[model samples]
Target: MGGDFGPRVTVPAAIDALRRHPSLRILLVGRQEQIDPLLSHCTSIELDRLAVVHADSVVAMDEKPALALRRRKDSSMYLALQAVADGRAHACVSAGNTGALMVLGRGILQTLPGIDRPAITSAVPTVNGHCYMLDLGANVDCTASHLLQFAIMGSVMVRAVENIDRPRVGLLNIGAEEIKGNEQVRLASRLLAEQKQLNYVGFVEGDGVFSGRADLVVCDGFVGNIALKSSEGLARLISRKLRRSFGLNLYRRLLALLARPVLQELQAQLDPGRRNGASLLGLQGIVVKSHGGANRSCFGYALDQAVSEAQMNVPERISEQLELDLQSRDGSVKTF
Candidate 1:
């Protein structure tokens, strides 16, 4: 986890994470002063399971990528990445610098065999039910080819997790018109339409993100990042509004007592941390990007989600589907 207040959050998060999941093992990497107390605080059984690497450096959120990596080779984040690459761990979960995570994850795990670029994927619930979005924020400036690759990964996720056959996909564009977008989006539209493996539903607008216009929403990271943040902000605002309504008066307070469970259910639905984090797709191993501000409950949720993703074998499924898509195309790296 990368943050200015590492001990304050990471320590508590790790403790709660262990309490929530009895079988989960954690490898704490940070300065001894920061990591030791947390490890000591864990239950005796959990303490036996907890290990530390005594990493002495850290990369701040604003530190430039090259500068952080060059100056802090033994940083906790770097050591954690090394654990994944060295096969010491099945997956790595972090609430740290995203770009640094992506950079380090790529350096260690590398991209999947057929994927041209790594995409960030997340499960998004629609008005109807749960679905997913790909390239949520990693590649801000995506190419037509990158979007196509994201579609493939998203399809695999839906099938493997939701058991959906030939899941439908939608491109996030200015208009549904075939040629309505900029050069990259326009080109991507054509590519998605031609991909036989995908159930491409054509272009969709931001309004349709959770309206069930499609099972998967694909976009460049810049737009996808904005959409994710907007959804999160709106969810929080709506939750606060509901709470205020319940808190209005004596009668409302009584009503609030009755409505507490309902509100809690709704808040759970909108809880960004409840969903925990987005999976970095098209990588050789699973790397969950938990929110950098995550606390104990949030970290536990992330660990649970990461376990599910690992058990689903997302990396293997992505590789298999991409290879099948590629091999079916006359044995060449042809355009989608």
Candidate 2:
């Protein structure tokens, strides 16, 4: 109900996911009138695995998080999160107001033990498969401790979801040197390096993120958000420039025709839709945030991400890892 296309996109995407995963069950939390019309498009088999829990109101895309939490208690986003908090669903996926989702998710699900706040994490395509980056905009300002927490959680997430036994973690910094970056980053790097459990690979510059220098990159939300958005904008700019270049002349047109398959493969590899879901890690329950403007296929990818995380038991894994780390330290380390 909160995405750009609302039920028109989500309903179909949910059905598509159900078809892909036969054991998957979906509880569509939205107004019946709006959701029922879309249900007609689903097959009988698809309908059997789907259920609609009526939520008469919706939190608008631009709505303030505080207002959504205070006034929109009956909203689809609220109920969907409540379902996860209530254990009725393993995870909640929403292409809704991101701020609202973060606020509501933290309020409902609560943070895992030793975690002060949840970080928004997502897989960024790299020269080598992909790398997970965290604090994508959950907390604009963070202390060194927060960054350390993100590194620990991100390492656990990548290891569980990507099947890396000892995922390498890096601090996103302006330069590779220990003398570079702000005081917060320098402190975070020192803290990360001290952790024997993590494969702390020191600082990784902006370009190193896609270079696959590390399996997980950690930073404060302000820096992480800027980096993520800048990469997205650059991807779009490059794609547009390539399309224009291919259409400039007859020779170029012919060249483009000859290179069509290769270009298509490259585009598919770089497509943001293929990596649409960003997990709100550190929370006790699973919540995946999709791009608000995502189409049905993109939304389906977000649903797939949710399913994957749920299957991996990511939150539990993180909690257990933290507990083990704390015990190993003889409870001297701070929980934040």
Model 2 lDDT per residue over 1-336, tens place: 867899899999999999999899999999999999889978898889999999979999889998888998899999999999999999999999999999999888999999999999988999968898888989998999999899999998888888899999999999998899999999999889888999999999999999999999999998999999999899899989999999999999999999999999998998878989999999999999998889999999999999988999999999998888788778866645
lDDT of 1 at 244: 86
Q: lDDT score of model 2? A: 0.92
Native-to-model Cα distance after best TM-score fit, residue 182 in candidate 1, in Å:
2.9
- Which candidate ranks first by lDDT, i.e. highest? 2
Local accuracy by lDDT, each model: 0.80, 0.92
| Residue 173 displacement in candidate 2 (angstroms) | 0.8
* Model 2 regions lying over 4 Å from their true place: 333-335
Backbone clash total, candidate 2: 0
- Write down the TM-score of every candidate: 0.85, 0.96
lDDT of 2 at 307: 92
The 10-residue segment of model 2 with minimum total lDDT is: 327-336
